[model samples]
Target: MLFRIKSFFNLKTKAKYGLPLVLMALITSQTNAQDNRSFQIFQFPANKIPTIDGNSEDWKIVPENYIVGMDQLWDDSGKQPKADPKNLAVSVKIGWVKGLNRLYFLYEAYDDYWDFSLPGLHNDTFELIVDADQSGGPFIDRFHPNPNLTNTMDAYFSYHGVHAQNYHIFTPAVEKDWTMVWGSQPWIKNLPYANASYKYDFKPGQGGKLTLEFWITPFDYAGNNPSRAVESILEENKNIGLCWAIIDYDDVNKTENNGFWNLSKEHKMYGNASYSLPFKLMPLEKQYKKEIDAKWSFKVVNMAKREVAFVDESEGEITSWNWDFGDGTTSTEQNPIHQYKEAGKYVVILKIQGPKGISQLSKVWDVAVK
Candidate 1:
């Protein structure tokens, strides 16, 4: 009972329509076909897929609504300006349903061509930031898929030289429930730091995709001095994809590193897997609404004299505030203060919550004994 009433609708067109009736027809017909046949998976080389659409650069859909495509990780503009590197890839492609919020993302990240080129151990990083209605969202861990941490598919090294522990930083937000998602930022191992990687699934549509964009940046080392490397990567590769782009630096001049030749000639490893971003709409939404800026401001006074003893009623959005008057306990309030029981260097901390999120400030006060 194979009814091949094929018309002229493309995958992109079908996704755009997103009709319930159309979806039912697709599920019914496709499921029927699969039930009669044996299935096999086509494992591809690490760097590229097997085919491309003859009609367009767009990916063609397979029998199971499976569509995949790869481009040499382009610059911000989603245009391939260079050839795919043997040791690493700088491009990404994603396939998902129309109107659905969640989509699976396959990201390819690579670095220099050293013998130690291992996944998650290179000097490269990928970060995805989602903006909705022009506002920031909560900090979602884009690296881990589940609490079990079993699915470490986000990043993979070519040979095996990756190393690093994962960490999280808290921030403030104004847009309420705005999601700021990004992969781990790593340190480059060497000139041919070689290959590194990271990946994760995402909840989209619940927040709209128009405002979501990726910032492909490179940093020398993690520090406070506004690392020079960030600006360097941005200026050099601004032409990379904005919605989704491969963050590659070595191929800036569109030339592969000489070291790649040595690996190809000596190791008998000419082919590798290209990065693929196959997005799927996940039926999930965030559990908690984003908190106000971690920083907050309020007034503090002395109860005995009715005098404004410590007028900490500062003017600003304080998401979180901690006051320690040489005391062991701490309080997180808009405005907080402690009375001087004895004289000592009392440390005061104010975790300010603003549009940019949370920041902690500490000041030492010399409380004197009268």
Candidate 2:
């Protein structure tokens, strides 16, 4: 019995004391590895984007209902197209891969009408060229045969020219990837685009999956801020705060109204940077027993400094919130209303929780204080 007891004591001593030290060493090593994992954008090597079937390419000529040689100034009083070709568009797809470092992009480009000019004179060959690691930066140009000109076999003339440009600058903490494309070159001026996109194959030091896709719509060119209409659409949602949307405008706040909001630091399955209403409106236990059919209710109000409190009770346990100053700023706190010291429209958002999960609601209210 004494010999068995001695062996058990030795085993427990080693496990209770030595095991934790080993775990600590392993965790510290992992932390150090994560601290050193950082990356920057190396120029994507230029390649000839092959045209498999020119006629059956993914792009639709004169997309968004804008046609060639037509008097469509802007998509709908927003931004104009870039050049005189009627419309400029590119459609791309990539085959899925197992890792983030290596990949391929298949793209197709088209003009407004393919060849809007000569009747039965429909011989238009296209070319896709990427100018990467250039003197300044990377550029993608779509080449087209000039309708009025000809080549060796009496085909239309073709040349490579960029309709838009894409480049990225990375800071140690924040990665800035930007793509600028125009709606119409000279015909419409207001709405040049900040491509609504980013590369999702990011290495956050940990092996994980990040994927994104964008839908680009070319609207009629509004002189210089074609994104104004898109902004208005976002404004309706009022989730524009802490976000950006790029266009040919000089507004600072409006700059972030476009692309995907990066939330990698949150360490969630899918990262998102958004606000939440963390309170609950529940019936008292006694009230619940007595009046099972009686409904429970609550309010949310905004009391932040120099901000207005606007409340929406269209849904959820959060019934109403007060706006102390009728300004666009708001909060999800019970009975919240606020007053602003300045005059301007503001974007407001709300979060509500239910038995299933949490949800977000947003709206933009224009407030002019007298």
Candidate 3:
């Protein structure tokens, strides 16, 4: 929930006690979304999930249309601020699985002068920002709920990336870790939340092509602890706000980067999520999907009365539905509410019919009650 911060404990207490429903509403609201929505995040089949090995063999199934090449990026920050393939060329491919709330990335790039000798942020980097639900606003520490705490470290701890996340991922990380999460919650970059692997044969300064594969979980409310964090649910056809920029340091001793190419036209996208480009989580390709298929999900309304709600999620043109509640009861309703008299564990079934064909699904012990 959007709580007005009055004191330090107020922010921590809200983060700790913020209800998921309200917090999710506050984080996922699209009131301010400026939909420059251009990219699609491909959905990989469950059996074809890509292994994070920094290899391109697994990503061959991804169509060429899903690629975002250097042509799409603008040099938002640089002396010349222009796209030049002679200096560097980069292409990015993104994918996601239906059940997993994570995004997989394959970054391929060739740079004439690959500079990453520094141990700090002074390196060739792929900077990214993701607002998984398109909840747009200043996520960084530029603004404050209370103006008095504007420049204080307390505000930095309480405000930076509370709704969105930014990552400065080194192209070929040297002695340092894979990325520097630009926020208070650095733990979000570790395993269970994120991972990375780089494949390259050249040294730090050598000019060559580099392949990097990684996956990260986007959160709407990622506080200090995972227990209170709210991971953004990935659903079909949802438009997420995402953008990236490349910070290329051609020379090791140069104080400034040679070029900064970003998918966004504005450089303020680093601190503002509203400036992020749109990325739709695309559904499975027709090649892997049935012309007509049956699917469903259930929500328990009240366990005390054994009341359950079933909703149809079938694919294609469905005309009718049949539901078997597994308690000597059945219904023809597309979505039905059923009540069980006495239940231990019961199997549920759903059947659907369309002009193309017919399909059915059965869940074993997916519904239970006292």
Candidate 4:
């Protein structure tokens, strides 16, 4: 009894969570709550990963419940609770695959005024910030935790976007790169780090709906040196921080935004990782759930008594189970203790059945007691 208590307390956190204990402590200490509501990011099956080719067909498999509509956003610049759909409407869906350290986004928006005539920041844009590990703190040099350093060129390279990344994504980039990563590591906005595609028909200053598909790899530490940068590890049920804003300009000539629709309640989400809301990396939908696997283990309870204890350790839901002791005897109990008439090496098998299907496991001459 004491051994069991000690084992539970002494278990290594790193082995259980795939993160070291010290790093977990640092993450817990740095985190801040900007938004109370938690959002869910759909887990796309590896085969169903959306292609960044301006197509909506691939995202059809995602359910509507995952949509983050304009209703959820706060108009930080416009100071409106919700934008008039006739003037501006937006919907966003985020996705992730199990092993890939990348985030996929499908952005759909309708604007009464599409202003992208400018060569630079004057255009309509989607600004995004992500703290992949939810290791929250200031990401920009201006808000650097180290108070003394001048928010100069030196601090820009050393601290800015090192813990979190920011991207000013062009809604429909005309003659420019798709996005501008707001830090020293501009490389993060290109090729292997990111890709974007847009589907729109209207000319600059014309009104139309736009569909933009994009994917970006978020980093825990991204500096000028890509070789030394650390990409955040994405896993099931973990929470990350993400904030985005839609920057709109009614007229192409103006340098300021007509509206800024933000996913976060606070405007400072752009520079502070703490202000980015928690987005959970959810498990796959029911249709994509893994099937049950039959597994079991046995220990000799008493050699003189010819008794053994069997344990069922199957994965996934199971309604029923059957175990074969290879001693011409069987049991239906999930975990059973059985006594054999004679001592001998015996093959053991366990079978589990659930809604998905049935699974069976067999061991040959594995369990033995004398």
For each candidate, give its TM-score against the true structure.
0.20, 0.19, 0.86, 0.73
The lowest-lDDT stretch of 10 consecutive residues in candidate 2 is 269-278
Output the better candidate (1/4) by TM-score.
Answer: 4
lDDT tens digits, residue span 90-167, model 2: 333322111121112232332332221212112121111111111221111121234343222222111111222122
Note the Cα lDDT for every prediction shown. Answer: 0.28, 0.27, 0.86, 0.87
lDDT of 1 by residue, 71-155 (tens): 3122322233444445344333333222222122333333343121222212122333211111111122332224443234333
Better of 1 and 2 by lDDT: 1
Tell how far residue 20 is off in model 3, in angstroms.
51
Question: How many clashing pairs per prediction, in order?
Answer: 58, 44, 0, 0
Ranking by TM-score: 3, 4, 1, 2
Candidate 3 lDDT over residue span 238-308, tens digit each: 98989999998888877999888878866789988878988999999989889888999999999999999
- Give residue 256's error in model 4 in angstroms: 1.7
Alpha-carbon error at 336 in model 3, in Å?
1.7
Flag regions of model 3 displaced more than 4 Å.
1-37, 142-147
Candidate 2's C-alpha lDDT? 0.27
The count of residue-pair clashes in candidate 4 stands at 0
